[model samples]
Target: MSPCTLLLIACLGVACPTLAGCDISMERQGKYKTEAPAPLFADGTSAQTPPDDTVAQGALAEEQAAQTPPPATPALLARGRERHDIFCKPCHGVSGEGDGMIVSRGFPRPPSYQDPHVRQATAAHLFDVITHGSGVMFPYAERIPAQDRWAIVAYIRALETTHDLDISGRPSPRTAGGRGS
Candidate 1:
């Protein structure tokens, strides 16, 4: 090995022993004693506890809930209809009957909204499935915005409400899946 390489290795070996003893000290109580350092992540941010805001804690959730528009807004439904027709209809069908042109061309049969399995799903479940996607369905997270995903959920609810038929004397709930009557 070169002299420089050997010197570097020797310097590092000597430094490691001394560095092992040095600890980070926080300046408090007028002391310079060794102390455990605050946890530092690889990204260089300290993993310290965040301060709690009383007003923002409970109030934020309530405020967000209040500020959030209803799931079944007409505007959202319209937007969802447009997005659904553009992106989902090729496979899910124009009316969400799950028999789109793609399916007719052997892309596999899509699930009909009126089907018993779909009828049992809550709106949250449908939204999650739509956002994350299910078997053979790619996730729409990248293509669909967060609010628009909810809008699509609203549109799907509209489909279920309008197209759902009574079967075995059970009518599907009118609201989006999961919301209590």
Candidate 2:
């Protein structure tokens, strides 16, 4: 061993044990943060997907929402409209026509709300797409809160129903994968 390192190590070995109140508790938890990756997880993510049949804490409201959707009141639609204008309008247009400002700027446009598939889709389906994303759309689950996501779904549904109140139970050819959208 190098004499300098050996001397320093000997000094620390003696001094550290002799120091008062120099406790390093092994029981202390690590300072792991919400967004930080946890290598201990098999998937290497701090945020794990809930197991198939289990609803995570704070997620019961969303699960209950799927089962007992509230009536679409005027206030709810207004809230939905406000949220949609802020989040979805960039790619869905003010009227949900898929010809948003971003579309003019060459972003991949989302499907129009007036499409039969979207018009007939359930509110839960809208929530899933908004939260999880589909095709070229990035998931907004992190950006938009769950309630706001549901509100956007309501607004989209409003737009669809405003145009075609008769649309229901009919599957669109695009949804059926026939290549004609």
Candidate 3:
């Protein structure tokens, strides 16, 4: 072989082994495979169970609040009105008639709270809708807290009740109070 060819072969012989030892590939890592037996752990499993009563951060309190609704009070109604104006009014309208400015601007109108089906829906149903959303409406869960959602339900109930009353504040003829005994 030529001198240059012999010198190149000698250099490659020394460098190749050094380069091979420098491998840092993640695929060749020493991590335990999922669900595989872990001899180092007492449980002998790769996955470790969370301790008893361990709730995910920020989840326990919100979950509890979501389960039980607070009683409706004037303060709650006022907070509801403020929250409603900020979050709901744009789509649901000032009177819960589903004719907000967005509708005038060509957005789809939401169902009116005064609709018979909506009026008959339980407060829990409303809360769920607000949390998870329905139809074209997006969820407000991330934007509105659980307590505020309950307050909005109370405000909607008040709106439905007021809508059922006549201009003189008496029950309308369609209601039980105005129906013949």
Candidate 4:
């Protein structure tokens, strides 16, 4: 072959192997496939269940707090009122008749705490609703802490118990007034 042809063959011989080695695909990376045997662990499984009783970081306290509600003390009710005013009043209204300012401005009215269904709901149910939300409401799990959610539930329960009755134990005008008449 001519010198030019020999030089081209030499260059190609050197380049082809180098170019082939340039594969940076993810398939070549060190990783365990799902359910594939992983020699790294003693059990030889790629997916390992957490060791028994392993609580996720920061989850132990959260789980405990979420499971137990604090007593309905005045301080808790006050905090709940404050939090409710900030987070719920806009949509649920000051009295929670679902006449909140946002509803007046055209947002859908949330259910009234005075509703029979709501009054019959357990405190846990209300807490779940606040945390997970229902209907058009968005979840407040990230925004409201668990304690605050429990406090809100307490305040809602208070609202349910007292919304209809005045200090003298008579139905308030809000309920017994011209509402139905």
Find the candidate with the highest TM-score and give its number: 3
Residue 166 displacement (Å), model 4: 2.2
Identify the superior model by lDDT, candidate 2 or candidate 3: 3
**How many steric overlaps are in each model, in order?**
2, 0, 0, 0
**Candidates' lDDT values, in order?**
0.71, 0.78, 0.89, 0.88
The window of 10 residues in a row where model 4 has the poorest summed lDDT is 172-181
Clashing pairs for predicted structure model 1, backbone only: 122-177, 123-177
Choose the strongest candidate by lDDT: 3
Model 2 scores worst on lDDT over the 10 consecutive residues at: 172-181
Per-model TM-score, in order, reads: 0.53, 0.57, 0.65, 0.64
Candidate 4 lDDT by residue in tens digits, 27-143: 789999999999999999999999898888978888789999999999999999999999999999898889899887888888888777887799999999999999999999889
- Model 2: clashing residue pairs? none
Model 4 gets an lDDT of 0.88
List the candidate 3 regions with Cα displacement exceeding 4 Å.
Answer: 1-54, 172-181
lDDT score, candidate 1: 0.71
Error of 1 at 113 (Å): 0.6
Model 2 TM-score relative to the real fold: 0.57
Query: 1-181, model 3: which lDDT tens digit per residue?
Result: 9999999999999999999898798998888999999999998999988889998898888888899999989999999988888889999999899988899999999999888788879999999999999999999988999999999999988888787677999887878463221
